[model samples]
Target: MATADAALRDTFTLQGVTAVQPRRPDGGFDWDWRGPRNDPEWAWFFNRHLVFTDLLAAYQQTGDVRYRDRILVTLDDWIAQHPAPSGITFSAAWRPLEAARRVMESWIPIYAALRDDPAAFPPERRARFVASIRDHALHLRNHHAFSGNHLITEMLALTRLGLTFSDLPDAAGWRSYALDRLARAYEDQVYPDGAHKELSSHYQRVVALNYQELLDLLRASGQEEAVREWEPRVHRLWDYFAAIMKPDGTNPLNNDSDTESVAALLRQYAPHIRIPEQTVRLPWAGQVIFRSRAAAAADAAGVRGSGFGVQGSANAAAANNAKPRTRNPKPAAATPPPLLYAFFDTGPRGTDHDHADFLHVSLSVGASDFLVDNGRYTYTPGAFRDYFAGPSGHNVLLLDGLGPDQGPRAVTAAADAAGVQGSGFRVQGSDSRFPSPAGNPKPETLNPEPAASAAPAVEIAWGDTTFASASRPAFAANPRAADWRRLVAHVPGRAWIVVDRVITFSPATLTTLWHWSPECTVEPVPGQPDSLIVSRSSATLHVRHAASQPVPADRQQITARSRPSPQGWYSPRFNMLEPASCTQLDQAIRAPLVNVWLFSPAALPGASIRISADHRIVVQLDPATSLTLDPEAPGKSAVTGTMR
Candidate 1:
């Protein structure tokens, strides 16, 4: 019987089809075996040849001749089946680019493993391998993606291949073109604040890994000048990941982000970068992290209690829970005041990979995620895709069942009229909301063109143990008929207060959506019309809302049911979806809409939220700590005593 590793190396399994037969001796493989050429799953499976690298690793580890033979056979089969400019590989621009990257990344290590052993990889085989790599580079150089990470990956692959095979006849031209394109992509796709234009933390990690490999290749080739030129930008990219990572070493699924990808990148690159041990704020990226000092102290004490050894309770706990929390309780907390990590997205509606989620926040206590962004399940365009990328999947204000401006495309006419082009125009429409006139216009009167939504003007502040950010009237779907402002403040180890204030001139329904991790259970607080108790093991999140208008008990709903209309589903990885606890607060807009969320480790000592007629919010987290927030002046919150 074949070992598990041997089986994996010998065959490619995808979409539940294990041990798929390889190509015929004549070198013809089934490109579209399951169904139509437009099958989304087939497209996804075809592009993800990541297993090729796995096979190479297995061969290196076990010195397995079977794995090496499999690699050679597969490479030869693919090259023969996908001849230059004629096969499925070159039919679509994206597929070819993806194949090029996968091939380049897979071939390098395999070549290294077999370099010294001429019998394993003879001169003829090496020549064939070089020819195949050259073809990939040439194909990528000619076909570029429309934008986003696709183009970036293509350029990175080209550059790596050119540098690796610098002795080839066309290597210099490929190297030069790839280098120029990569530089431009860094400037265009990376924000000045170090955030990727894609806005998805997962994609940010992808871009980072691509650049890290590029730098490694350049440095190996003695290209110090090139390495220096790109190092700072790459470091900034790492900084964004460092700032957004949670206590569990994963990032919030703010857009189409896969939790697994985020965790993998953190594991791969975190040690090489200079990540601060405490709180961090990236104002330009509109992100902030508040690390609990108490949590750190407790972790330190837990290690000491475990004999002060290298393998302490902290390490054991981390090791036990290394896989992303699927449907289990988090490892036991080290002590009181568990690590609190929260991410607030107040920046632009990033590139195509980003969802229309503005002012959406994700919260976690220790290793367990509580409130989370609905993750990207698949890129296939359908109802699921729309819901995942729309406001329904996020924790934000949904007015009259409509999300932020998610029309087919942004209205560039207004920017063109203003004589602005490129980024100046793009920045003008970052808010993802359609502009409204000053008075209430009938729904039919609203137009998608000439007046688009303006980007939210944001203000952020970071203190020793507190972080605060506010967005002003960012959503105006109808011309001035409604105004929305989101204020988020976090006091590490204590609580997080999010206040959503909406003022409307017309009759509208306001719904606040909160999506929690699938492991959490949510229920309405007994006898409380506007509160919910979300419990996950020992940790609990106390949610309380106070509004000037009447809020009925029937307005609150907690469901883990999946529906076609994006209500209660969480996708931690691509192509997988699970039911999650989704809490919605529905209220009629008569006066200002104010909803408050207070998240903590356990039931609070004194949990009461009062909204005065004058629009001032008073929140009491405990006997000694209380906050008075003036909605009109979010930055001027008065604190009675120190909770820390």
Candidate 2:
């Protein structure tokens, strides 16, 4: 049997594009590997030289002369074409930092593997490589990004390069400056509860991996004090992953995130840190996860892998059972099943790369994701980019057909207005200029009023009933017009309840949207205009709404448009998008508006809801249990009563 490292070496593949495949050294080389590809951005990323790591690994495992020769030839060609402090590699500000970082990371292992082979890494060629690393590191030291992940990546690369070349005259200064910046990044970037302030799961993983790599280098170099100081923060970062990771090992596609899994991170680092098995709520991070007890029990029994570990046995069993069988399967147990997994987000108005998806929720059952966040496809400025990063891509309320404000600046403006409005109780008139209902408002024209009440606040409680609540200004333009409060509750073995309440001072329009996977189908319940059935595979969800007046049939519709519309779209990967089912319900709001949705594996029986004159809500989920909510006095509102 092949060793684990050997197996990994055998399965090496470069970035999915085959256009830049390196050729053998025939006394001549092509430094410009992109050839005639028109995509400059793709070529830029490809030419970063990260893929050389694969060649290094292959040569180390198999002792292949071809792989070793190719590495030297490519390095020689690159150095000859782009000298120190010049050429496209060093001239572009972004490329130099990234190229310096990737080159250091990819070349270190190869240099280590071939250090003894004088023929492969002759002293002159080795000096050239060292000079290139010095130039790249000096360039990064001179130029710095403003903040966020870019700064983090650049500093991390410098730290690694400094440690690797510690014998150099200025290496100590480089290490000190890089470590100081890293410490500041740790304080500013990672939230108190381990969430990356940028609020992107994809970038969270990226940042975590960068930290882990730095720590590993520290440990290898006997820097115990540095490792000790940084270990806990790295563990906190992984804990966030353990909390929000879905049943399928992926995470919620929060804010500029892709459909990437945390399994690889866990697989690499699980042995070093402690992994949590129970549910957790990261209050500071504005995230809450409701884990299934049944799943936990199975995981404890070793029937299912824990903490994002690979399930090799389960995969083998599945592969063995691929063929159809005539035998009858055993009946399922009669006990109540576990509640589906649920993730809630009510974080701060995110940073630059973050999306405006406040109070968004994602749910999954077994291995299938039901309600999902429209993932970020690309950073390119266009219709798709705007939609994925806006409020319409999430499961939230769009008041008067308008999404939330864009970023921290907009959020601060709204909060300041709310402070003034609350002190004076002023209401803006209809003549007040607001954004167009089309959902695209010019930056200069966006002056959303503050809510008459207050800014959004989130509360979480766990036990028999796991739930989280967020109360916030629903509309940026007409913040004083209405206040929105959302509650998400997970009742194990029963159902998941999503309650949305909007209290308005004047007439307004409320559009509640739910985005599901492309595989799901939705339809209105027969003879029940207030309810809809959303089904995907074996799971189903029943959504209901309570309004002051009857809803017209035209206002409730399901769409799966491929265009860049707000109603229906899904992006599974970067640079790719497809149509997905989006169920929308539009209702006219005069007084307090309450809408409830119940999700279950089995069909849910009909329930009754009553709203008192004082805006209190009574919902009978089943014959045995009832829930009462009074928005006016939230502390005293949540009561469980028996249905008579």
Candidate 3:
């Protein structure tokens, strides 16, 4: 109501920019009221007309006719100013993505609300409104996003136009064309394991929402056969989102992602949703979810047959529905919080939303995301643009500051990145997810290699606690690109062991980075040991480097919000920045190097280590979590651990 009242007075704030968009002397809206020219996203976001939805919602809530009047007047005036196939103009309202959102976010909902309100939408005006919707649909049909999440949403909106207004002449054609495209897009955009191709948790959510909306529309439009064909795969999309989610209810900021929460939405349909495993792995996406829910508490309480792997308890339906809980509560000594929720991205760069953070891991203890990624700061190129999208903005390896083979198509400041992947920012790409099946047109032309061409980045055996990934792409373009492999293991109810081995016969500078959440307080251990106590709220994680594979004292330093460099910074969301702890270890190496980072439940005790001359690593964190990593360990057996 406040927002609608504000809109009535011609004041609108969006994307953190507030402006009083007062009506003109003639009481017509000025469609070109650009607020805050400092950020490039302002104009683009403003043109989407999502703000107009607020007015319609207000009218429905209060039954205020003036709120209703504002929606109609704004819609009519905007339509009058910009004809279908609108000419190139400063408004940027005709951009197909803006058009798509306007259709889904603005036109469809508002039209449904007021379509029968003849006092507001009389016959003549109603015909005009519907015609404008057709124009938007036609524009979208001809000119759509080249590819990526935006394309999926646009197609869904187009399909919506066809179904909602089936009475229209070309509505059937619109639905038919969009349905075919959407089906093909599903095959291309999603991996075999159900992770979205962009590999961004945020974009994955976006694509999944639109995809689900498409399913809902299909069922509502009396297309039960089509719904049957799509439901399973569509559920897989939801499955990935549910898996990679952090303990705090948000997924990691792996690629171009926001700290988005899907817990509440998932809870509403808890009974129908799948309960995530204690450890979830999407092999195709090279993602591993190393987590411990109430299972640890169950073990301590001698609670048997809690059905941890089967059905989810009622509480499980909420909070990403990640963990299954106990149906009957046994009196516990204390309220046992969830433990060690981590998202390890041991995968290739996504086809879009590519952050150069291969081998990146985000860790959350209980409710706090103690370790994190520098999120997508903004789509605009300046200040933190390259930093947020590049290797420095991530937790990964850098050789002489050279990152993953970004390829020639890497987004540059001079390049207009729209047609590339919707994000004009530099993102990691050049990934070949799952191979296309026979008789399928290769997914996106922007991706050069056939999906089958690239080697598997990682291998996993669900029965085993340890798995390894070889990030060959990370070193493919480097002078010393011979070796890049990492092993990640969950130590039951104990610890997570991450081991990285890089071979560099030639002398070069190797830098390894770990980006921590801004809320975390990282204090170095009070000794010569290379360790830190990472604590946030009541959760504390002990982090240490193996003594055998140690970092030199003089070579390590911590950075926090350095303006001269994009290091030590984190983006909670787009256009938001905060200082974060980024630990960088630089070592000048002329031989093969092995680095082991151990994160345990309690403060890390000194661990025994043995590195043979051939680079075989034998490290023991505790009795239950000893690991032997051979230099020639195949992708599947990257690390042989004691648990197996």
Candidate 4:
């Protein structure tokens, strides 16, 4: 056996240790050094584990004796605060214990380097660290938190324990169990299309970190057989992350989101495991496209030199020397496909685990999201808080402020009546319908039906191209809500259409205008009872009812105060005519009005009518307006454009 001097030969000094906060120069880092907890205790614990892991790594890499001594003290402190016998340490949602176990086992290398040096340390201190490892491991197994947060950590603990203590009879059995659990977790946790359930880019990075750690350990132990088997699975996880990244470099916060430390992990591992940019479409997990398959393959193949994959591989090798080198290199992944997707919500009130939107849908063209569902704002308030569960946050109606009748104002019903499932996207089957206003004289009246279904069943078909068809229901939400009645606020609702054309089939009642303005501002044109307009740079001109027409005067009252909008403000402006010429607009491509330019106060002149070379008549809406041709009026050439 080597003497203490020889055992310490491999130790390296830590440099950044002195600059870290909440840590003594002697090496102890505070677990709760950042701030007070605002999240659940379990989540807080998870955060704490990160701090602990970093501190431990600093100690191990620096080989600073002070760092080791500090780790011992910190471990003692943690053990005292979280006693294993109490059952509370592993209870509830806590995950730090799992991390604690893994870190303890990793210390085996340090201990083995000193095991023969009886004079270097007191017997009691050495025994404490060793005993702590076993205790934490047992606690993790008891809590079942091991596999839930990526089974990699627990697997490391088991493998390290087995390697360090060969004499223990249970070590062999535990190793087998750990290995099997890992395989099962991988199969179960990854979605059918390889998306992570947590869906957060940060969480994927975390999973990748754990995977690299496990793979390194396996290789070091001469378990190349197992490492080879896991190569593709590991690559797929990275691919999943790359696929979900948005064009803006942000990953949509679908599940748990922790932006902190994500960039660091990406920088650390991205180079080694360059995930391929292959398109992976999972309609169920809300990932319409994934373009990181290539990067993943590079990482799995352990390609080195030149690319991001090489950097990660070098880091992995440097971080742990136990891994055996492999020659397998992943081939480049295929080019990603142009992914278009739409999300539909059939669930009621969206308070249930699976719901919050009854008729909300978001559409994505490639990486750009066009129509979007405003994602979660706050997590507390039990997921149904007003901001996350309100009509304003979604593409649905507020229904006179009497939205879907969930149980309490604070609590919403989780109703998922129907939904669509496909390879690349999912849409909710909605029974949400509204009557065609053609026959109803009072189409703008606010009527409530408790037993009414607002969603409609729609059919989608994809071949060389794609098309979606849905029979119009008796009712639909008004795009301009407040216009139907005066004093009553109008909430805008939207629906998605994929075909080249959208035909209303029936002569649909209610005004339809394609609106385009970055800052959407819809207001009644002053004095014009039936006409209203919305503008971003310009204005959308709308006329709800003509003065000559007998309209519901009770519903048409002007507001006393004006609301501020992007272009300007709207005050109590009335029309010059007693009743404006509120012409019923049909087959008309209307554009919202725009101030010609910064210098030109001239309003948008109506679009120039043109006949195409092919003899098709074309009516262009104002540039500010993203108008939809009257789907009810078929065979008419109508087009609208909105500025990006």
Model 3 segments more than 4 A misplaced: 21-34, 86-91, 293-337, 406-482, 547-562, 604-606, 623-625, 634-644
| RMSD vs true structure, all candidates | 10.9, 11.1, 8.9, 17.7
lDDT of 1 by residue, 1-644 (tens): 13326444444555434445344456555544432324445534544455666666677678877766766776666666665663334342237556565656666666767767887678887787778777777778886675788888888888877877779999899989988888898877876546777778878877888888888878888889988887777776776775666766667887778775344464566545433334454434444555542322334343321111111223212564556656776665544334566777655566768787866778876666888998988677887888788888898877667654422222212222122223322211121122222222222222222223321222223111101112223333444445566777665446677777777655566788888999888887788756677776535566776665565423545554545465788888876788887887777665556666666554564678888777788888778878777666665666777665
Off by over 4 Å in 1: 1-11, 14-27, 34-41, 44-49, 56-66, 86-94, 112-128, 261-274, 277-279, 294-337, 406-481, 551-553, 556-560
Can you tell me which runs of candidate 4 are displaced by over 4 Å?
Answer: 1-69, 80-83, 86-121, 150-168, 260-280, 284-286, 289-644
Which has the greatest TM-score?
3
Report residue 193 deviation for candidate 3 (angstroms): 1.4
- Which run of 10 residues does model 4 get worst, by summed lDDT? 592-601
Off by over 4 Å in 2: 1-41, 58-69, 84-97, 271-279, 292-336, 406-481, 504-508, 551-560, 564-567, 588-592, 639-644
Residue pairs that clash (backbone atoms under 3 angstroms), model 3: 354-428
Tens digit per residue, CA lDDT, model 3, 1-644:
78888888877777656877545677776555555545545656666777678887887788888888887777788888788764422346777778888888888888887777779889988988888888988887887776888789889989989988889899999999999899999987787666787788888888888888888888887888999988877777766666676665666887888887756545542225544435655545656676554333324333322322111122222334334658885564433435567777655568876876766767766566767888997877766778898878877777776675432222111111121222332222111222212112122211123223322322222111111113444444554353566566555445666676776665566788888888777788887456777766545677877523443424344565556666888888776778788888787776677777777655435455667766676657545555565544423233343432
**lDDT per residue, candidate 2, 1-644, as tens digits?**
12223322322222232342344476434434443333344545545656567667667778866676766776787777665554334332236555655555666767777878998878999899888778777867776575788788888888877888888888989899988998898888776556677878888988888888878888998999989988887877776675577766677888877787675566667444333323445544545565543222223223423222111212211233356655885653332222357777644545657786766778776556778998987666766667788877888778666764322311211111111211222211111111111122211111123334321122222111101112234433553556666666555434566677676655566788788888777788798876777766544556665653354324445555546465578887766677887777777766666676766544446566676666676666666666665544443334364321
Clashing pairs in 2: none
Write down the lDDT that model 4 would get. Answer: 0.35
Ranking by TM-score: 3, 1, 2, 4
Task: For model 1, give the 10-residue run with minimal summed lDDT.
Answer: 462-471
For all candidates in order, the CA lDDT equals: 0.62, 0.60, 0.64, 0.35
Q: Candidate 4 on 300-355: residue-level lDDT in tens? A: 23332122111112222223433464698455443232232343322122112222
